[model samples]
Target: MASQAFEEIAETFEFLDDWEDRYRHVIELGQELDALEEEFRVPATKVDGCASQVWLMPAVKGQGADAIFDFRGESDAMIVRGLVAVLQALYSGLTVREVLEVDAGAELGRLGLDEHLSSQRSNGVRSMVERIRRIAQETL
Candidate 1:
């Protein structure tokens, strides 16, 4: 259940014939994200198990399972920041329950990220997803 914004990215990935072009597109997506405020970059929001420093701040609206789930994230590395943006596109605007239900690996697989990313990057992505899932669960 990808969001419309994510679906658009996936479609663009499909149109891009080479991994280089897709990689550039991912970086471009990251550039579109608002800079995460320095105050929110504290340890409380920092995601563990990421090779690159990463922070994710939850922004839930309402309450319980129906609460809307959203987060702002940042990373020291450019590609990792893009990965955060991808995660944002994947999870933003979904309800907490919907966020919990997302098959992130499967959704990202559509973009061939699994094949393209390095082992460390893949682990970082997994860490980000786990953090997001935990946030959604806590919201519920």
Candidate 2:
């Protein structure tokens, strides 16, 4: 099932016709996210290929097909942090298979972010998704 968070974000983006307003909303979402603890911000959890320092920690609940993963992530950059929030909204509490199946890039495109973000930022988003998928694959 799609997360309520994802739906809410999409709706908010739709309601905000201006890209500037949407960007502000994304930044606000990042500001509202709970910060990851210092201990969890280790080299092991750090995401590569991002211009800004980013960390992701994953926790699995249940077993087999019933399993759902929860992710906590943080980034030094404001926009990057917002991107992390979006990823969390889309992927957290989803089964490993469901996480893999989600077309995150397409969703991002739908949000009109693909055209708005710099190439480096776009690549960073891809890197984050790759890291999440890798974690899911390893757990499976």
Candidate 3:
């Protein structure tokens, strides 16, 4: 599953190719993600300590292993928004434990994201992933 997600992420970045294109793709992915109903959209689903406004909604698809996630994020910063989309694509629809176990920092680094970002921006991206994992752990 991780490998599959990795491949998907690689494809995503490849599809975008350039920084401008990447940002557009990210926002596009966010647009593609359907928003959850208001009832399930609670404070508990919110990811804390993020530089961008981020909301995460987790749904158990079937049994204990199948799970799905819906992420809604808005950011004044375009790159930050793109970063959110990367997380959504890689981690959504994974099992709770699988989501928790994703090493987003490493994954992002492997994808050469940090090289393209400022230190502060990279930190913000890390904060988003950690917070998402925390939310998943809380729900699990």
**Candidate 3 lDDT over residue span 1-140, tens digit each:** 45475567677776666777665665676565555567654677655666665555654454433355434554445566567667776776677778877777777766678787777777777777776676566556
lDDT of the candidates, in the order given: 0.94, 0.87, 0.65
The best-first sequence of candidates by TM-score reads 1, 2, 3
Q: Estimate each model's TM-score.
A: 0.98, 0.95, 0.67
**Superposed model 2: Cα runs more than 4 Å off:** none
- Model 2's lDDT to the true fold? 0.87
- The residue pairs that clash in candidate 1, if any, are none
In terms of lDDT, the best-performing candidate is 1
Per-residue lDDT of candidate 2, residues 16-61 (tens digit): 9999998888888888889999999999999999999999998878
Off by over 4 Å in 3: 1-6, 15-17, 35-46, 60-72
> What local lDDT does model 1 show for residue 129?
96
Task: Pick out the ten consecutive residues of candidate 3 with the lowest summed lDDT.
Answer: 62-71
Cand. 1 TM to true fold: 0.98
